[model samples]
Target: MRSIIRILGVARDLWPTYAAIVVASLAVAGTGLLTPFIVKAATDHVVDLTQGNASGIATVVWLAAALLAADLANTVLTNVSGYLGDTMAARLRATLSSRYYAKLLALPQRYYDHELTGTVINRLSRSITSVTGFVNMFANSFFQMILTVVAVLAITAYYSWPLAVLLAVIYPVFLWLTTITSARWQVLEAEKNQDLDVAGGRFAEVIGQIRVVKSFVQERRELEVFDDRYRRTVRTTRTQSRYWHTMDATRRGALNVIFFGIFAIIFVQTARGVFTIGVMVLLIQLVTMARQPVFMMSMVVDSGQRAIAGSRDWFAVMAELGERDELPAPVPPTGRATSAPVEVAFDHVSFGYGDDDAVLRDVSFTIRPGERVALVGESGGGKSTLVSLLLRLYSPDQGQIRIDGTDVASLPLEELRGGIGVVFQEAALFSGTIRENIAYGAPDATPEAVVEAARSAGAHEFVSRIPAGYDAEIGERGLKLSGGQKQRIAVARAMLKGAPVLVLDEATSALDSRSERLVQAGLDRLMAGRTTLIIAHRLSTISSVDRIITLRDGRVDEIGTPDELAASGGIYAELLALQASATTRDLKRLRQFDIRV
Candidate 1:
């Protein structure tokens, strides 16, 4: 009961629609009662009368005409109210969808890591549909049942108040059944919904990484896992369906038997002359009418339970969302004369994803404006983690990160992110034309500026070679282009944004020697007057940077120019020697390949 009220609270803004639906439902019930009364009158006068008098026949005709009029009115009212309810539900769905999307965008990146994308998508789809459908149907059913029950009681009382009182005897039993079945169904629905989430998550995971599965020859293993999950889902649905079917059958069958007994008793009284023919006919019709209202009670309860299960999921998402603080009024970009170009700084920052296992411990670094700094380290050495912090994808557990002395946390997040550009290791690109992809963040950039940026990023030659040139459509994630081509386009996009600071995460590591030269030339031009942080595994990529910082165990191991670090005999020196050895092996392999040919 408490949960139902809470769900209805969400509908406070749509109560006018609810009220209109109520009115139409009452009209339907009133019409149903009139229909039976018309039959009662027609039967008593024409069929039970002596000599079939013309006056009686005319009276029966009038009753039939009245029934037709009532039916028309009921139809119109129902159509109007049904339309209003549908419209209100649509609006509510829109509001909920907008809130869900906004919450996703506002959350920190860590939230995404902990949750599955498919689970979130499935919840948004199913819960919204369930909640809205339940509200609409439940409202109509409740109002119609109330009016029907009242009319039945009035007619039954006219026959014999004692029997009407006897009919009331079954109310407690029906109510008890409604409560128990509803609770059971609610629990079952919740279980089924969770199973769906799991199944969807698994399916999405496998599909997204199908190449990995195939390459490793794990297709049979993955299929077996999926089949197990699917079988569990089917079993759960079967159990729920069985419970619902048994409950519905028992409730409906018991009510019909009780109403039949009432009708038989009334017929006995009519034969004995204790009840008039007209009254007996009305009693029979009203007893039949009682069946629908009683059955409706069960449906209303069932629908309510299903809705509560769905709304609970919906509200969980709403409650768990993080609040985004409103942005301050826009301020024009400052730091002209006194303001330096993009200077990146991290101040005594200690941070972790969730626990005390810090990824960056007391990390402090400052890159002077217009300097190119390279962050190099083994995988999981906190190099990428540090870049994520700079991007404000996650805030530090302690201390602060600043851009040009302004703490990034204090600035509007949009403005802060807009001031810097990054090219990820994977070179993430959406499906779109080359021109559109290059100006993704800068939608208003002119075509000439876009072409110029592409030229500066060494992408113009290859793009021009394509059939559509700059207008060529790249498939999803730029799968249509080579890995090097995608990276070059990513660089061109960053250059087009013209942000003062640039962060490149293994930007050129995937390219061949020729493509690397072209992309390197583009990077040099883009980094000329901007502060740049480069994360690279290849030794050659970072040699030209102003400084190289080697990371070990979440802290800086060495920071110096390339020559200085090479001679320091620290972690940097060892890494350089290992890479040089690998390169020598690769060259020898090429020679062997030529001799074999």
Candidate 2:
């Protein structure tokens, strides 16, 4: 009930339309009530004519006209109510969908890690549809059913009070049964919903990683997994369907028996002359009228229960805390001036991903403006975590990080992030033209500036050689491009943004020597004059960095120039020696191959 009220509250903006629907509904019901009376009068006139009453013919014509008028009024009002109901449903759907989408964008990244994409999509789609269905059913069916039931009972009482009393007593029992059945049905619906979510999540997981499945020749394995989940969903759906059909059959059976008994009673009373033929006919029609609401009551209750279940799931997501931007509003940008280099300082910062031990423990470091520093460490030694902190992807558990002498937390989120450009090892590109991808970070950048950035990133030569130049379409994630080409495009995008701070995470680690040379040239140009932080695994790439920060076991093991660290015989020295030895072995193999040739 609370969920239903909340959904209605979301549709509060459309209250005027709802009001119009209500007025139309009432008008239709009023016209409908007069229908049986007109039919009753017309029947009595026919009886009078058979009994040789000469004026009965004119009376019958007038009664037929009245009945036709009432029917016409009912039809018109019902159509008007349906139009208003449809309009209200459309408004509610649009409003709720937009709100949910905004909430999705605002939610913190951590929320997405635990939730499946397919499950979220299903919940969002189902919930909105449920809300709309509930509103339409309530406005068009349930409201009319109530009014029709009440009007029918009143007219029945006007003819015979005992019959009306009997119906009133039976109505409550039917309602009680519907309420209990619907409650059980709602529980089953929740179970079915869970099964569907699991099935959808599994299917989506398989489809997203289809390449891995095909390479491993595990198509059969994936098919079996999906089949298992699908079978479970089918079982749950079948059980729910059986329960629904059983309840429907039970309700109809009960109504049929009660209606038959009432009809028999009316027949006996008429034969005893306790009622006229017209009254008997009217009572029989009213009994049929009463059945409409009783039958529709079950359907209304079923739809209500489904809507309530969906609303609960939908509101739960809406209730989640969104990512808060703690800083004040952004200052307007001053014309096209270049961003100055950023100075960064980490002061006693510590953080953990909801663990007892910190990933970065009391780490302290600083990079002067325009200095290019490389962060080198063994895997899980906090290098990536440090960069993530700089990006404010996660907040520090203990101390603060400062940028340009100001605490980063105090800066507007957009302003803080807008000042940094990142190029990951895998160049993440959306499906779009090359020009669009390059200008993603700076959407309003002029085309000349985009071409200039591409040239500086060493991407212009190849981009111009393509059929459409910068306008060529790149498939999903830029899969159509080679490793080196994708990295160059990514570099071009970052360059176009022209942020003061650049963070490169093993940008060329995956490429071949030739590709690496091409991408390294682009990286060199991108890193020039920027306060750059490079997270490098290959020691050879960072030999020219101004300084190296070596981390070990979540603490700074060493921080010095690469040459200084090499002479100190520290962790950086050990890594350098290992790579050197690997290189020597590779050179020897090359010589042997040359001699053989």
- Top lDDT hit: 2
lDDT of 2: 0.80
As a whole number from 0 to 100, the lDDT of residue 149 in candidate 2 is 84
lDDT of each: 0.77, 0.80
Q: How far does residue 528 in candidate 2 sit from its true spot (Å)?
A: 3.2
Which residue pairs overlap in candidate 1's backbone? none
On a 0 to 1 TM-score scale, where does candidate 2 land against the true structure?
Answer: 0.90
| lDDT (10s digit) by residue, model 1, range 114-170 | 888878888888877777777788777777876777777766777688778767766
> Tens digits of per-residue lDDT for model 2 on 306-359?
899888888998898876623334433211237678799999989988755888
Q: Which stretches in model 1 have alpha-carbon errors above 4 Å?
A: 1-13, 48-50, 53-58, 167-172, 247-250, 321-340, 461-473, 583-597
